[model samples]
Target: LAEHVVADSVLVPGVALVGGGPGDPDLITVRGRRLLAAADVVIADRLGPRDLLAELPPHVEVIDAAKIPYGRFMAQEAINQALIDHARAGKAVVRLKGGDPFVFGRGMEEAEALAAAGIPCTVVPGISSSISVPGAAGIPVTHRGVAHEFTVVSGHVAPDDPRSLVDWSALATLRGTLVLLMAVEKIGAIAAALIAHGRPADTPVAIVQEGTTAAQRRVDATLDTVGEVAKAEGVRPPAVIVIGAVVAVGPDQQP
Candidate 1:
């Protein structure tokens, strides 16, 4: 059906890398939802909530490429191959990723692979988890008095240069917040880095999990104890970590 719609356009044999948004089904954009509905094959990650999957037509094929804690199924290469394979078969493929496709979802790598294979590709942007998670938890990444700026860091960087990717010293000097996405596993190391580099040990920290979802949960504490509280509270990965004086103001308190 999608092929028919694009039959005249030389670009029908392509893949759509769609962002499924951050866990919450409602967060999915109308364009993303429409593309998903038209997809012949949908490849999704763990963070792409199952609710979104259920929205697909019974006839559409849904593939799980999710990277979960216990399951390390498909590699980037394998996922790329799968996308190409389906596209070559004249299938309208949708790589349904959690959050924005380009934001740390490795959508760029996949796009490069598809391009190499001469596959047409387009992106459908969705809300990024880093900022949305914090906002949904009643914590603004930036505030008038509390923060004039903010930095977003990823945990998937070179282990030796995580600090280099972000200047802890500058972050310490700025009156702003630090948003760490995918850094749940390195909370201890990150906290230590910021503290050692001059960010106050008592900087407020909050970890929000399953953000914007019905099951959303939050753990709040100072930088000195966020790591401990996160562990003790059984906070899982795929959580958003917020640090700064801004979060100190109660959730109801606005900037």
Candidate 2:
């Protein structure tokens, strides 16, 4: 299990951006956990596990590099500087992210910055809260009998032009599942677009927040009303929005 990833790439001399996996410390992969234990400096996101941070050696230096969601805050430049400084000290630094580093975790941006600085950084993938959240809430992204295909999209986009990257018309007709991550703010617009594009207004949808963690919460409703219900339920980000017939497979379960 562990050999496949690193064999695909090399662990470099600079910082390693590790995925902490959803919010559960236990969900961290074996190799990832091992790396955590060996890290000399650990920088993590807001959604990463508190318990995972606690697992680190007491002497390990830690930094909080989280950006305030939907708010103006820590610029990527500042984070890059932190990584460079730590690595320059010849310390084994790990930049831990909430979910998979590649999935909107800004891992790419940091990697690019590191590359420009002649630093060699490694990326360690983790379970994305997007897929795991939905599954934990009993909504499989794809079910053989129900859905054969699925799409995952970041819902954090400009409200006016959210469909720039997403083909709303085609997605509505996919008849497959659509898992939207970080879309709590844009859920209404997203669902409305799907409905307008022929996706059933009553399509079953489940909003799972803090997915795969002890704080996980699920809210079930149809596409037409999920946004409203989710709002009333106070669902936040660090969420996964699952939509399709598969959601009906376990209708009795509540989040």
Candidate 3:
């Protein structure tokens, strides 16, 4: 594996996994931005700091991981191969992902593939939307004396789905704040499962759409009403759903 180090902000010819932060371009880290600016080939996702793509030099090759010539987005294997191919060609590659690479970003999978291919992979952390999005909506996942702990979970799969690995029963028993990503469509099932277990139906819940972006909107409801509220409001994906008493905690408390 070609081992490359980011020395004095200099990026060598290898693959750098840069976290583009939640949704705001300004939220991207200094290191992430610097790497993007110097990248010879940037493989980007739909969720990252897309605004920065226009700033890249015309000579840089920008590959949309979510879109390909075949009319279907590139799959994970294809993305890994793209990185390897670009880096093998001596081009500095940047795999720009949304939020922290390890936070449900399939970053570890990419890193493993790169390592297997003997490619030097650099991981740059970004602010996860789990916490940042809630905070942006004026809700803290953990508040002093309110929620002592916070758990971040992916709601991409419904509780009734056999593909789901999450222990809804165990999660219902926890007293900490629950931050759900990709759960808007399955909020009803999730709420039912949680309520069926041990979670209180009256627990406060806040759904923040578009998170920290300019289109951010927050909707409030109790666990009993959240499922319907989400549907009634036409909540969409990329929204952060916060469940627990912390939703009602500060000056930004929602109705």
In terms of lDDT, the best-performing candidate is 3
lDDT of all predictions: 0.81, 0.80, 0.88
Off by over 4 Å in 1: 1-13, 67-74, 156-166, 250-255
C-alpha-based local distance difference test score of model 2 = 0.80
Highest TM-score, which number? Answer: 3
Number of clashes found in candidate 3: 0
> How many pairs of residues collide in each model?
0, 0, 0
* Per-residue C-alpha lDDT of model 2 across residues 1-255, encoded as one tens digit per residue: 011123325444677888988887888777677677777888888887768887677899878876413244357778888888778778888888888899888899999988888778778899987678777887778877888988888788734593567677788889888988888898998899889889999899988878777788888899999879988998887788898888887667545
Model 1: per-residue Cα lDDT over 1-255, one tens digit each = 134133233344489888988999989887777777678898889898569788778988988884322235358888998888888888889899999999888999999999999888888798999889998998888877767888887854523473446665666566688888887877877787778778789988999988999889988888889878888898887799999987877546545
lDDT of 1: 0.81
- Once fitted onto the true fold, the runs of candidate 3 whose alpha carbons sit more than 4 angstroms away are 1-13, 69-74
C-alpha RMSD for every candidate: 3.8, 4.6, 2.4
Instruction: State candidate 3's TM-score.
Output: 0.93
**Candidate 2 backbone collisions, by pair:** none
TM-score per candidate: 0.88, 0.88, 0.93
